[model samples]
Target: MPSSRISEEITFRKLEALLAFMETGNLAKAAEALEVSTVSVHRALHSLEEGMRCALFRHEGRNLLPTEAAHVLADVARDVLKSMAEGIRETREAAGYSADQLKIGSLYSLTIRTVPQVVIGIKTRRPDLQAELVLGSNADLLYKLKQGAIDAALTGMPEPDPEIESIPLFEDDIFFAAPADSRFARMEAIDLRLCRDEPFVSLGEGFVTSSGFMEAFRIADFTPNIVMKVGDIFSLMNLVGGGIGYTLLPGRVRDMAAGNIALIPLTAEFDMKQTIGLSFLRRRERDPNLLALAAVCRMTRIAR
Candidate 1:
């Protein structure tokens, strides 16, 4: 249809005035209801009637009487206005702007302490709020944050990125982890060179711990013998506990497994630290929901 033929002059404000006038059946009352001057109300209805290209009112003596066409348009306008408001509200919520629920992504290890503390603190502060935890590796979590699949992320902070906003919560040292019954458990600290020939079960490619594991060995000038690679942290920890092979882990997992696992410190030369942080899109830095989450993060730092 041509734009000229369509009611291009029709607008929500006109529809609102039409509804008010239709409800009150008085020009002064409609103006008062809309918090506008009587002249504004008259102009709105006049434009609406002209846009509709029909007789919406008829003058009877000194008063204006609404025609049946006006009543029909009022009913439809009411529905349209209500639906528009609902659409805007739902759109905001779908974009993670809702205060009723928060979607938080994190490294699987942080679920042991840091993630839980932040979740609890935020919930306590916002009593009506609900939280969802999405656990993955560091790479996985940061990818989700960028994709807007999660509202915030708790993971090992990456080197500075322009698009991401990172709030460093704490530094968690990487430890040389092995079975409790292993001979290395009795040692004061782990020397990576001694374990170069030792078979290792590692958290696979995308994990932050996996990168730290590789870096420590690289600093020690040796390549670790790889026995297996797993997706999640828990599985790697289980492998270590079952005497499968030695692996590296962050301090957050120190007490996660039973006494079967021992977390020994790394030698000075092989020292590596994973900085855990809360991260989101830099554009959403001032969002109320994100600000509240940041506040909780500020107070919920987990001690290694």
Candidate 2:
């Protein structure tokens, strides 16, 4: 029978060691799992039994057999340890550290250099911050921002929205990009109307680039011979590099312009640029994680 007299010598760690030993049914195996010496595991179990003033185990030759009292204690120990872990997690989340992961959203095109800069800057400021990037179009990123799925978004800045707040990072011009070997590539500048007969690959709807892509052609007063539509900017770049079709791309992606692709300037009449910014929900503007993100954004100065 177990006594009601409890000892201050009992500790959560000793109970953990006891649970490990009871579960494994071997002292060496328990120590190996806990990454401790076998002697340490044996000592902890001995202390736990002494603290509770109960016979938790008995020796059988060289092996040890757990008593019914040990089984009951181990069961309670399992629940207690699990609850403690959950409580710690809840505490951290309430303090505004999201399991240490900072989820951020951005457009596919900005991944070239801008997103990396922000991620590195934020992590540098918060060494414990694990920056996670989620890529999508302007619409997709904004949707995630409002849904509370991401801490902030690096995307093409939209007109002032009542539900959101933004800080402009930089501006990038939309340029006509074609295969280097194509006839239009040799031109220093291109007229949108001249490319009406040429095949084009566009970004799907909701993309900021797609809006500029369509608006440019609309201003020229003729629909382009659009050959295909793709989801990501990298894929669009690949297709253009492969000579699939010419498309409008932001100057931020100029690093990707090497051998196969040529980025030609758009004529003044059709020239357009996108303002890139860091956006977050208006309600959560004061959130510590969002504030950290805004601080990083304020420090950024990306030249056009």
Candidate 3:
């Protein structure tokens, strides 16, 4: 494949005209949006097509229909423009050009339970620290932390990496949750063998909780017959609420009970608990802001 021409060598003014043309679908509207004459917009797009050596649009009445090449180029151009806007925003934020804000990332499961508590605790301890919370999956949060998009994050025990360091905050055990009217709900403690034949609802493979639950089941020497594989704790709990199937969820869920699902402790061969912790890049250890955030994480715990 041939290397593309340098962005500087190509005129961004023509690219902007093409983007405006795509959005408005008509020369008059495109010219209005670009704040230029209809003749100017037409000339810019014609010149852009000349540079690219392709027909970008087809004329039908007053409307212009994008060709396949135009469609593909428009997608890339949209992303490029969006990223440029984001870069400008982030640069402004980092240059002390706006109100200072601390970015934080946390797992979706903890967004309702552990995260709010930590935010309140941070405010009480450091009233001046302006904070912005970003909720994502463990992998997504880890990626953000590594990229310096987030100063610190709260998640379950993430697999170790040389650049990342995890500090233990709390241990959260898994328990069986079932509808109050279900047969399993009557039991205070559930045996793994007894639940082997029961219908199971659980998180799928992408989540940390599901990964741990699968390993625990294997270690306990039982293959669970999962009837439904959901994405988040809320949906899994809802499935349990409707008595779809019993599910194993982290003890942190005790903090946010939305339904009449019985929480049963498990005394099986393998003990399952997700070690909730704070993760940050090892290089950021000495940073004062991150250090203070780490201290705040240590003081916060799952509500009993």
Candidate 4:
């Protein structure tokens, strides 16, 4: 089809409904947000299909899901929408309003160290802008990013998500931490296999740290004896310090002096290093706050 024909056929209302469906992942919710009845939302979506000359939603029971075509067009819609938002924000800036506030999310371990340092630097450079930091497990953070709930995030590389463009910031080595009175405390670098039988405390399952720790052990051909599970890095360290069990933690935990705890490097002949980075939707790359955040991250060093 010609570009002129496509443009003439497309209506803003239909595009809005399509994007809302993509965001809500359901017709009823999208309808509520659009302040229209479910039937109206459904009609708009069906008309959108006719205009595009392609099927958008794949019907499965009561649910309408994005087909491959819908997935492709959804990206285009997001780009269009983001451009519109940027235009509006530029207008607001020109009218003497501060730049739109940036919402950032962080993994728990980073909340204790890296994120604060970066936020301090960010505020110093752009004192007029507002910044909010949210802390959660990597899974939760990534979910919020997909939903447009946050502007950007500092997290361990969760996985290769095509929607998210990641800037590599640092590589954090996982070390076994234990209290001085514990059996594994005096070790310099221990083989991961030797520690498989040792009771360990670790981050909860949804956390990236837990995933990385398990992946390291799986590659080394063993399952860990995880004795306890905790949500944050500080608690994991405190547990290890109190001799609950050994735990795998990043180098940042070393910043504090805990009397009985030691961080022992792993001697496994595999990549046990956790890659830490900032991530944002690829479509949001041009947003001023996101671009500025990426710039700040670029100035920092990544541990090898």
Candidate 5:
């Protein structure tokens, strides 16, 4: 086979044949696995080997023995096939071709209010659409959106990534959450500097809330004595409610505040606020489900 043909003609079907033959170790079994004739499998392998200018198999009696080259090609073929499959799925989603299924990513904090309202609104508009919600931290959701794993995400305004288009939904005020009975909780507004010596329970670093919490400390010109770092907001809030340590959270979390936990608004020169938004790949703007979800986000009044 010519090099030009090898470069341009090595299709996914040939790679699939190569992988199936290597795994099954027999032309007949490979054919059965691929739902093709044994002759077709043999021809595919032979053409692939010829195209690559290498021997991929040795035949003994009726069985075909795979060479080391075959094994290497099999590995590469697996990755190629997997990536191709993912590409197809992503392309279909971007073209608004899903079978009435919409994948949405969101922050765990929004599950209580923002997420449910958006889901309800989408269902109301498109009765046939099924909204699948995936909850994670801001970073995780943004990563998924960029990877084309989710149709859209409801998260904090991530540092600008040119691939992502963020539609600002609402702004949430940051507050200091402490044990209800504590002296700091009794105050109308907590001064940022007053908590300099207090133990703090914070969300792990990748979270948008964590960044805001750290920024508040930075503005106060003091390093908080962080005692524990947790993955989720609810767990961090529970730790504060149990008197483990105080934590900084947005106004949205106030609804879930336990009776033992007090949420005091922050009064400081640095306005500690989180801008929540709907984010998706800029290329996916034409997707119907994404457009519908965006409409819902725009119309729905997110409670704080």
Candidate 6:
């Protein structure tokens, strides 16, 4: 094949089909994996062989046997595809195309305050930019950030991962929530030791608040008599109001507290606080949207 034919006919789609077929060892399975018809996969593979001017496969009755050359090409194709994907991502970052839209992830608890302020600050800086917010638990947000599903996240300070860069925005004190008429609600500040025997309503394990709650108990050297483990903060608060059990949350949630629910500060000894921050992959430092969002998070003050 001429060099020009190789350049013109060897498209990325054909290379992708070749790789899929090589991996699956069956044209129909490759077609299903690629969400294409079997005929299309066969056409792509044929086109690739024609462009290379080499017999990549041979027919063995009903089976297609890959030649040694096919294996070599498949390996090279994998690297080429990965390089192409990285090139496109870097190009978009450099060209500022991604700056027009930012994808942000955060804990649902922050959506009521911190996340909104950060979004506003970013929009103030770039009026044409769009922001999409995804709210989930701490573990979920961090996983999505690592997977590149979201450009950045506002969450509890995650453990130091070399792949991730975190900017600490502010520290929030965790307060105890109880029914208004409860004896604990009458106190100005309550120590964790004082409530050791009280039934507790907890946020489930994956939540950032859950870690802090556990830490408080650990510091006090006692396990909470937890009666319920919930997915969201509001549900926990509601349960507290209904006199089911008490829970712990940040001071920022005071505004959303129901009249029947009372949020009491903790004593200095039980001063459990979570460091809320902005996090992103260290490799994405140069991405304009991520940089813009990070800038806003650094300067904006979230109400305590």
Full-model lDDT for every candidate: 0.87, 0.87, 0.78, 0.79, 0.85, 0.87
Q: Which regions in candidate 1 have their CA more than 4 angstroms from the true location? A: 1-5, 21-43, 54-68, 90-102, 121-130, 144-151, 159-165, 281-295, 302-304
Clashing pairs in 5: none
Count of backbone clashes, every candidate in sequence:
0, 0, 0, 1, 0, 0
Candidate 2 versus the native: TM-score?
Answer: 0.68
For model 4, what is the C-alpha lDDT against the true structure?
A: 0.79
TM-score of every prediction relative to native: 0.77, 0.68, 0.63, 0.65, 0.68, 0.68
Tens-digit lDDT track for model 4 on 184-294? 667768677777668888899778878878887787798778889988877888888887887777776677636768877877574477788899998767766777788
* lDDT (tens digit, per residue) of candidate 6 on 57-119: 999999888899999999999999999998998888554446567888988788888887888
Candidate 2 structure lDDT:
0.87
Evaluate residue 247 in candidate 6 and report its C-alpha lDDT on the 0 to 100 scale: 87
Worst 10 residues of 3 by lDDT: 92-101
- Give candidate 1's error at residue 32 in angstroms: 6.3
Runs in model 5 lying further than 4 Å from the true structure: 1-98, 302-304
lDDT per residue (tens digit) for residues 1-304 in model 5: 5544545446799999988877886778989999999899888888888777788888788667888898888898999899999999887866545547888998889998888888899999999998888888888888787776788888998778889888898999998899989888889888888777889999997789999998888989999999999999999988998899998888898879958889888886856888998888887787777788888999875533
Error of 1 at 94 (Å): 4.8
Candidates 1 and 3: which is better by TM-score?
A: 1
What local lDDT does model 3 show for residue 286?
75
Q: Which model, 1 or 6, shows the larger TM-score?
A: 1
Error of 3 at 98 (Å): 13
Residue 266 in model 6: shift from native, Å?
1.8
Question: Across residues 52-82, which tens digit of lDDT does each residue of candidate 1 receive?
Answer: 9899999999798899999899889999999
Q: Could you tell me which residue pairs clash in candidate 6?
A: none
Deviation in angstroms for 118 in model 1? 3.7
Please tell me which model should have the higher TM-score, number 4 or number 6. 6
Scored by lDDT, model 3 comes in at 0.78
